[model samples]
Target chain A: MERWQVVTVVVAGYLLLTLLIGLFAGRRVSASVAGYVAADRQFGLLAQYFVTGAMIFSAFAFLGGPGWAYAQGAAVFYILSYGVLGIAPWYVLGPKAGRLGRRLGFVTQAQLVAGRFPSRSLSLLLALLSVAAFVPYIMLQMSGAGIVFRAVTDGHVPFWLGAAVSYLVVLVYVLFGGVAAVGWTNVFQGIIMMSVAWGLGLYIPIHLYGGVGAMFERIADARPELLTLPGLNAGGEPWSWGAYSSAILASALGFTLWPHLFMKSYTSRDDDTLRRTVILFPTFQLFLIPIFLVGFAGVLYPSPPEAPDFIMPHMILQTGLPALVVGLFCAGALSASMSTGDALMHAAASIAVEDGVRPYVRLTDAQQRLLMRALVVVVGAVAYYFAIVQKQTLVFLLLTAYGLVDQLAPPVYAALFWKRATTPGVLAGLAAGIGADLFFFWQRDLRPFDLHEGILGALANTLVLVVVSLFTAPQPEAHATVYVEPEEEAAGATVEAVA
Target chain B: MRARTARRLAIAFFALYALVLTYPGVLPFNRIRPLVFGLPFIMFWVALWVALAGVTLWLTHLAARRERRGR
Candidate 1:
């Protein structure tokens, strides 16, 4: 068989397995809101760990990790910084969120914030913003799947078709099983990705440069700057330590605010489980080092006349490895993309249902499940459209999503930790941060003080939140207290309190 | 305190150490050469941190089990 033919069969077989797993997981779904959204909060530590890991690994790990490593050299360390700073805050915040989620039966982050502030409109607005942010993020994952398919198949199966095939598998299972399907499938995909990543990380460098150290030495001899911190383009006015550090900080702080990640906190069995997952998350980060090595190898071997994102895939293809090994590598990349896509698809659907639809219409348990399934298809379709239309570098698209979605952090942080944080304050902060981020991103000439656009936006957002919240009366303690109490305790309360 | 809570705290501390020790910019040294496990000093340190996380979790689970029996 031709290489592309082999690639098609392997990728198709992988998708079939994902579909099978999704269908199988449908048996576990309970016929209630909890079952549809949070897997009835029964996910064990291992399951939660894998799902969280897979959620983050996404296309960024497969494509952006190596792409940045190849293009920017040592500056790619900023990517690693995220895992460190990101999970620490989650140890405290995620448990609190989880506890509250259990107490209030909240399905989405917007619901949590809205419930805390006693503002239905704010929840609806956040839902809208989350969907907008998630669409671009989902697009990046779909586009990544497209890139992988195109590369492996030598363009025989076009990007859209490849994306469609994988997404079809995801939609089939997710539509039936909901969060159960997403969580279980993520476990399978996460294992495949981590195993393949470590195997490739060790094997590729050894095959290329006799050993890992030798690979570094070869790159050092050829282009010494590639191995050093601050990287080659440092003196260029566009990049700086201030910009890099601030960007890393913003990414770490804002990471938990993503609606999908927030939802994961709700799925944990308890506070301890959430904490354990955060602690073990670095093991996932350790796997990325070898993936980064593939990009470093690119410094020794020049990229062909194609996109820079193609460098890692091309390196894997040209490694003279067996066809099965190459197929497995493709599967790993696919796993990364699909795992992320499934989570985003589920989150987007839940946001639409719980936050978007619930306020307007009284939805029964069965009706909510039906609505979630339909919304999954809708979210997938929107993302598929962007994947087909917008073909940009994965890094650029990802950074833009990171910058925009990060605006949610101020409100999220305030809701959890600050009692004085009011609805109007959150609204003002979100507006300022999102507006500044978009302005700076679109009009590059207008970036104030040579900082990352995200930093400026975050600062403006924080300032508004502080000033506005100080002036505004404190939110009713009754509104916020519901979230902090245990579920059984809160369950005894009258419906009027929740309403 | 519940054994589970203690175990969780241990895991959190281990994760915190790994976060600080492995961060690229935070680390003061570059290319410390006397290797462990055929990896660089920094990589070795990180691997130990990862292992420590696992060990801490195991210990915490044991403590939690013992506490449960006492209760």
Candidate 2:
């Protein structure tokens, strides 16, 4: 058989395995909305660990990470630095949020906020913003899948067919299993990604340059610029420290605030499970080291890929590795894309129904579950159509989405910790923060010191939240205490009972 | 150590990590030479901090657990 055919068969085998795991896992959950949206709040340490890691390191990390390392050099280090910083706060916030979620029956980030603040429009706004961010983000994951298939299969499978087929599999499991399927498949995918990343990461450099040190030594002699921090910009110009530092700061702040990630706090089996997940998180962050090595291996290769993003597949194919290895690599890349894509689809649909529609229309629990399932398909179809048919670039929107997501942090912080935060203050702060972020995003040249728009927006958001909250009538003392200083002993007992 | 003190120290460590890994703080450590364990100095620097963060967080968890058991 031809090599591409062999590769295709292996990939097909992998996808079938993923489908079986997802479908099987789906059968174990209850049929309630909580079951679908929050995995019935029973994810233990292992489940929480893989789900969080796999979702965060998406097709972007698998493919774009190497691409950045290949073309731009150390600019990719910014990606490396922020993950721990982003997740560390979760150690404190995760259990606290989980406590609130269980008590209030909140399964979404906006629900958590609107629960504290009690505003319908605020919930609607959050739902809208989250979906806006999620659609383009999901579309990008599809594109990443298509890119891998097309690159590795020698274009036997076109981008459209590749993306459609893979996502069709994703839609099935997510529809049937809900978050349970997402969790289990992520466990499967997460293992594949780490193994392939390390296997190829180490193999590539040693095979080509004799050792990891040798590869770096050679690059240092030939392309030393790639070894330094705050690497080159898209234009290949030297990147300023201002842009680099702010990228780290903005991304770190916005990381856990992504609605999908924040909601994961609601999925943990117990507060301990959540805390342990945060502690174990850096091991996953270390996986990026191998991923970066794969990109650096391509730096001195005889030929260059058409685009830097193609570097990983380009290297695998160029090196003429065994057909089986090539196939395994393709499966790993798909895992990265599909794991993230499923989470986005599931979260977007859940958020839409829970926060977007439920407030305006009163629906039975059965009706709500049905609506969530239907919306999952709808969200998938829309993202797939844009990914395959319209083929628009969603990178700009994804970046803007980060800035928008950062605006969520202030309200969430106020809800859990600050007692004085009022509804009007939250609403006004969200509006001003989003406005400032957008203003700077569009007027890029006007930014002071080339700072990320998200940081600027956060500053505006906090300032407005503080000022506006002081001027407004405070929430009743009784209501504020429930969130700010809930009796820990009672909360812990309830959590244990539920578990 | 007291749970509160441990928590305070963990937060301080994370804050110091944020400072030293970015901007003016990172400026001193960012370099290609003096490769440690086959990684560039800056790369090693970032990885070291991340690993240390894990240790710090684990200790904080233990401290919190001890305090809770006492209560």
Candidate 3:
């Protein structure tokens, strides 16, 4: 059969399997709010890790990682650096977030912040920001599926049709099964993704360039700049280090702040589970080193400037490998993209219901679940529209969300750790940060420094939070106790009732 | 909570990471050697720290189990 035909069959089969699994998950779980949002909080470390891992992987790993490495060389190290930074902070924060979430019946990060501060407006604002930020992220994943479809089929299957077929499966499964389906599918997808990553990471290098050492040696001989730190495209300025380092810092700190990642904390069975997951998460980063090798190989291929992003797909095609192996590779890429898209769709829907709908309309457990399922379609369609329309670089789309998500952190950190942080202060700070980020992003051409627009926004946000918090009256001591106390002291008794 | 101890540990870890990241340049060129598993000495340390964290978490889990039993 033609490669495109093989691609179509393999992709269609994967989607069909996913839809069946999702429907099965829906039938298994009780149709309650807890079942829909938190998987009834029954998830253990293993399931939580897979879900979190798959969520973190995204299309960025399969497509953007190799693309960036091909174009920028060693500068791609910043991507892995962010992963490391992102996972490390979870050790302290994840447990605390999880503990509070369990105790307060919090379903989203917005709920956690809003409950703590007693500010419905702040919660609604965060819900809006989350939808706004995640829309582009969801779009990027859809676009990545489009890119993969176009590549494998050689443009036989249109991009929109490919995205529609894949995402419709995701929407069906996620709408039916809720977090349980998303988590279980993620486990299956995560294994496939990691195995394929390791296989390709080892195979392509050995197959094409003899071995990793030889691959690097050949690239170094041809383009010595490819292996060096700060890399070849360091612009003309020495101050690029500041920009790079800050970008890494912002990404690391900002990653855990994203709502989807934060929601994973709620899935963990205990504090120990959260810590175990964080400690083991770095192993996934080790898998990424090989994908970077594919980009390194691109140096020899000499890609066109306008089409650097397609280098990895082109390289994969050029291998003339068996259709089965190619199909498996495409399945792995789809896994990475769909896993992320499912989580984003679920999170966005939950945010709409928990933070947006719950405040305005009193929803029963069943009604909330139904509303969430409906919102899955709504959110997926909104994201699909953006995916079809927007043509920005994946990195640009990612950074835009990262900036807005980072704005959320100052308030979150304050609410968690500091007793003095007031509701008005957090609300004001968040507004300033988001406002500044949007303004700077619009005027990106005229920025004073080469730093990420988010960094500037974060600084303004932090300043406002500090200044306002100092002047405002503190939260009552009783209210602050909920966040500061240990899990056993705060929620052990209550959690037992639910369990 | 011992604020000073946590603060100190955080600072020490940050400093250690910074040194490890920059150590290739700090060391004499002739003295440096690629270590076990074909990774550079500095890169090996990154792997080491990651492994250490895994071990620490395992130990913490054990401790938590013991505490649960005691209760």
Candidate 4:
């Protein structure tokens, strides 16, 4: 077989394997809503680890991560910084969320928030924001898949066909399995992702530049600026501290706020499962060291790919490695893309039914499941269309979504931790934060010092939430206590936790 | 509760992270000339803290375990 043929056959086999896993994982699923969305809350610690880890490490981390390292230099550290900073809060917050999930029978983030701050409009608004944020994110995964297919096939697979074909695999499994499929598939893919990341992250530098230290030595000697702090601008000059600082802050806040990851908190079987997930998450963050190394290895190569996002695939193709390894690299990248896309497709569909349409109309469990299944196709269709045509940088597109989702942080944090925050306070804050974010996003002028728009929005949102809650009547004390200190705290505490 | 103490420790841990990983806390380590692990000093500095953040959180995890035992 020809080299590309070998690559194609290997990649095709990997996709088929993924679909089979998704199809079979659902056999154990319950017919009830909880089973579909939260995996019957049966995921043990290991499953919980991979599910949450896979949810966070998406196409952006796979492709855009290397892209940032190759394209933006020191700015890539922001990715590393935020993943840890983002989840560290979860160590404290994740158990509270898990407890509340069980006690109130809440699975989605908006459900929890609206439960605390009672409003149909609030539910609908959050649903809209989450779906809006999710589409681009899913688009990110889709396009990341497209990039892999296009690169690996040497343009035989066009961007549109690659994205469509890849997401079809994602849609089928997600539609059938729901969160169970998302969990199992992540386990299967997470194994591939880490191995591929380490192998290539180490191999590329060693292959081209002798070693990672040797590669950095060359880059430092040639383009000293790429090695320093305060990162490079799009123009390749020094980036401002305000931009650097806020990007880290905004990303960290946005991490736990994502609709899918927040929902995954409910899937954890116990508090220790949630706590252990946070502690182990940083090791996954270690994967970035290799990812960035892979990108940095591209720095001094003669004839790098025109677009920085294409650097890794371009390097893989250019290198004369065995075709099987090339195919595995393609599969690894696909793993990165599909693992997150499945979660996103499932989350978007779940939100559309549970939070978006539920308050307006009642539906039976069977009916809601049907709607979510259909919406998976609908959301998948929209993201696929955008992925085929959209021209934005994959990492930047993901960041834009993160900025918008960042608005959810204050309201979510308030719901879990604060006793006094009111419904109007949370609602008004959402409006203010999202409004400011949209306006600044369109205008493109920094408020000053180049702080990211999301950081500015978060500040505005928090201010409004606090001030409005003080003036407005608080959520009823009895209602607030359910969240503030749940009735079943003892029951929720694991023996390992309480012993 | 022990959960509350664990929560406080986690908060303090993240604060220390924010200090080391951002802005002025990271300001001192920004240099290209000194290389660690074949990484530029700034890159190595960030990588070091990334490793440290894991260690710190693991310690907090242990502390929580200790608190649980005490309870």
Would you estimate the TM-scores of all the predictions? 0.88, 0.97, 0.90, 0.96
How far is A334's C-alpha from truth in model 2 (Å)? 0.7
Score chain A of model 1 by TM-score against the reference chain A.
Answer: 0.94
Q: Is candidate 1 or candidate 3 better by lDDT?
A: 1
**Per-candidate alpha-carbon RMSD to the true structure:** 4.4, 2.6, 4.0, 2.9
The residue-by-residue lDDT of candidate 1 on A61-90, one tens digit each, is 788788777777766666765665566677
Off by over 4 Å in 1: A232-238, A302-305, A482-499, B1-71
Error of 4 at A357 (Å): 0.7
* iRMS of candidate 4, Å: 1.2
Each predicted complex: what DockQ? 0.18, 0.84, 0.22, 0.76
How high is the DockQ of candidate 2?
0.84
TM-score of chain B of 4: 0.72
Task: Tally clashing residue pairs in candidate 4.
Answer: 1
Docking quality level of the chain pair in candidate 4 = medium
Candidate 3: residue A55 lDDT (0-100)? 90
Select the stronger candidate by TM-score from 1 and 3. 3
TM-score of decoy 4: 0.96
lDDT at residue A435 of model 1 (Cα atoms): 88
Pick by DockQ: which candidate is best?
2
lDDT of 4 by residue, A1-499 (tens): 7887899899999999999998898878898799899999999988899998887898899999888888788988888888888888788778888888897899899999999888999999999999999999999999998898888888888878888888888888898888998899999999999999999889989989888888888888888777766778666778888888888998998988898998998998999989888889888888989989888988888988868889889888877889999999999999989999999989999998899999999899999999999999999999888887788888889878987999999889899789999999999999999998887777667566788888888889999999999999777777787787774544456654877
Model 3, A1-499: lDDT tens digits are 8887886788778778777876786677767887788887878888888888889998887788887777776556667656755666777788888888887787789888887888788989989999988999999899888888788788887789888888988988898889989988888889988998888877777888877667666766676554444443424222255455556667876888899889878877788888778768877777777777777677786444335556666777877777777777788888999999999999999988899879878878778888888999999998999899897767658877888888888888887888788888998999999989889889877655566778888889989998998899988887787776655345665887889
Off by over 4 Å in 4: A487-499, B1-9
